[model samples]
Target: MKKPVAAVDPLRLLVAILLLLPLLALMGFGMLWLWQSGYLLYWLIAMVVCGVLGYGLQQLLVRQERQLLMNAATEPNPEWPPSADAVWQQVEALSATCNPEDWPLEDGRWIWDLGQKALETVAHCYHPEVDKPLYELTVPHTLLIIERASRELRRDIAEKIPFSNRLTVGDLFRIQRWKVKAEKAFNIYRAGSILINPVNALLSEAWRHLRERSFDQARNELHRWFLRAYVCKVGYYAIDLYSGRLALGDENYAESVTPESKADLEQTEQTAEATNEPLRILVLGRSNSGKSSLINALFRELKTVTDVLAGTTQALEPFVLSREGFTQALIFDSPGCDSPFFDSKQMLITAGSADLILWVSPANRPDRQAERQFLDALRSYQAARMDRRSAPLLVTVSFVDRLRPANEWHPPYDLTDTTNIKSANITAAVRAIAADLAVPAEQVIPVCLLEGKIYNVVDTLWSAILNHQDEALRIRLMRCLDAKKRAEDWVLLRRQMAGAGRFLRDLPEMLGKRSEH
Candidate 1:
């Protein structure tokens, strides 16, 4: 049978001190008044008498009250044994079980188990009918359990891996920090709050740690924890967002594929060059901006058709195209760059490693998001190059054939006839879009990559590539990419510096508040 829990007394020994404070203050004040009136002996006598009387009365009252309570109390029960010995024994056992040699793996497992138990305990203890006790007792207990678990895990990791070894130490610290964060998140979750951010952060860090190590044990541990963490995060976020518990605002929540998202990571062990390296062409635009159709059209002209959608091209697809001089270059079709889903950081990282960037846009519907992303990516590419020169920014205006009536669609236009009205109209339209994109008017070329009888569409693209194959063009492209990258870096650096300045300025005030507490 469970023993009845006693209510904690609000009035403790400290309450007596609080109650006597006013009387003591008044007595002191009276003595001071007497002394000022030239009654020093009287003041001293009164103070001594009151101090002795007050102390005696407080002690006597407290003793009598305790005696009365004790007389009314029931007989002591032996069924409920004291818990101190059992708790100490458990602590000793735990200490003995946890060894430094077993380190991160053993400690990590222990923490994981403790966290699960704590969660279960709290869930069982929580009662809407007994809100105060449930919150005050159960919530704190849960936090302590999580904290203890986290501390144990951190200590174990620290002991197992010395700080000097970059790989081991870095991975261990990352995992430990994540465990701490997970504890904080679990606390928040118990209060009916979402824990997606921390869970995501934890899993992300764990993924990095696993990727850094080749050891089977570490890798297995990482995979297990990462999956669990990711499931928790995804489920929490999905529930909260769908149920209107979390705000989505205007931010895009498109799933991003990180290095850790790969299922067969062993494939990554191979050199990047061994794979079919495609000339990654980045198509940028808003949704429904004909970016998909443009790729379709290009593939159609090349006598091929492939999947088209943002992130549809899971991996870069390389297509070999032969030019007039029997020259060939690999062309790559990439995922469309759309607003919200367009990760500039990842895109720039990819662009830095690409040989060329084919910036594609549709003639009918132009998107500003696509234009801006392209420029940003190009800038990043230039910055990453050894020599800062702009890569050949080949701008292609797709679906030009759509401008004419379907039945009257022509294959090619007369370049020599400057007075040709139809040719002039197409040229003007292409130039206008180019101007909007901030690309040079001369660099923009209109090509109907989809037209069955497309005149010189392939030739035009090939010619542009051939013309810029020289060392000078390479140098120029590199410079342009570098300049753009530098500009972005400057902007980011300035913002970061400003933020640091603000933090420094406010630190003193924060510290002052903390000290007072």
Candidate 2:
């Protein structure tokens, strides 16, 4: 058993008093010396000068820190909704209406009120039909949003502002209390000093008012800085929730690709990339457009059978590609769009799941009506799903060797130098394909996927793939998030079933107990 001790120990109290007596006596003696020495005025002036300098230094540091936080606050996340610009403008306008005079330094309720208004601004942009969008969130999800916002604010403050980690709201209140008492003591001193030395007191009063004005301005700026950060960060997460971008259980999927492992895979091929779901790349084009040859070239070997006949690939074939400098992915060789028996609906479903697409169009083929129609349908399908990111498309204009200067087969053909007949023909073919497919010219890469003569396969084509990997990774994240959400739904359903089963078993006993009562 432990013995109980009093709140204040007598021995400790006595020791503290013993320690404080000498400090008090020494201060009294120093004051007596200052009064008699007649150099007290000079000593006081020095102290005032030092205090002003210290205050100026602190204000400068605070200004720089606030600037950094403001920069971060004003920048919106790339994944935010299309109305993010207008939402920010709305928030800024709302903030402009806030009166600094009404917000006291010690009171914090005004921030909560301002945050409520900010959340309404965000809800107006995302879900105007609902009168109370915030109330629609589940308790756990609301708490999660708060936790994420608070964590970001803490991280930014501790890292960007010096000494912020060491301070707290309680410390600020304590400092405010000290400032009040100091002002009271200075007022009394000024009253007495004015009668004794009129000129000195007048100068001191002017200096004190100047410092006070500067302090008030700094204090207000600090208050507004915190206000902007709080509102912006909270609204950022709120907009994410309302727009269906932020959800629970995403962290579990994100954890599969850690920083260290991703760095390893990107730096060296010896290390295989870790991923819960592989990025899906879909290959689409007309029949006999060198689709198989292009896939074989990407693999650096013959992985798919290529025939001179059309409609060789009748179905979608998926291949696992874990190449160097690329995320682990599944590349699907889709059936050609020109086939008479092709199902456009099934192809649309496959396109929806793809993260990156490689459209193989032969440079020799002039008939592109079928391809153009299919592309228009694909674009319409993607446009309907506004919440999902469209897969990046790269057009590979194959069979460039069969262009106008058919006799000239060159190893290196610079499209920029159009003076050469072969280069000019290839460039014209690329531009025509780009215009027909409604894709950017830069995305169209002319390649000869012919056997034993693969031009632009290793450098030009692979570089395009690598460049689109970041966007592909983003699409993959959304894909994984949807799968994880479905899995979570199943888990929650099981839990609810179990709870209902237990309640049914105990129903009779509870009813009997209630009757007895």
Candidate 2: pairs in clash? none
Which portions of model 1 miss their true places by more than 4 Å?
1-315, 320-330, 339-341, 367-369, 380-388, 404-407, 415-419, 471-517
Cα TM-score per model: 0.34, 0.79
Q: Which candidate number maximizes lDDT? A: 2
CA-lDDT, candidates in order: 0.47, 0.77
Q: Write the per-residue lDDT of candidate 2 for residues 141-206, one digit (tens) a residue.
A: 677667777788778777766689889989989998998877765565566566555655666687
| Each prediction's RMSD to truth | 29.3, 8.6
Model 2 residue 131 CA deviation in Å: 2.8
Top candidate on TM-score is 2
Q: Model 2: how far is 517 from its true place, Å?
A: 12
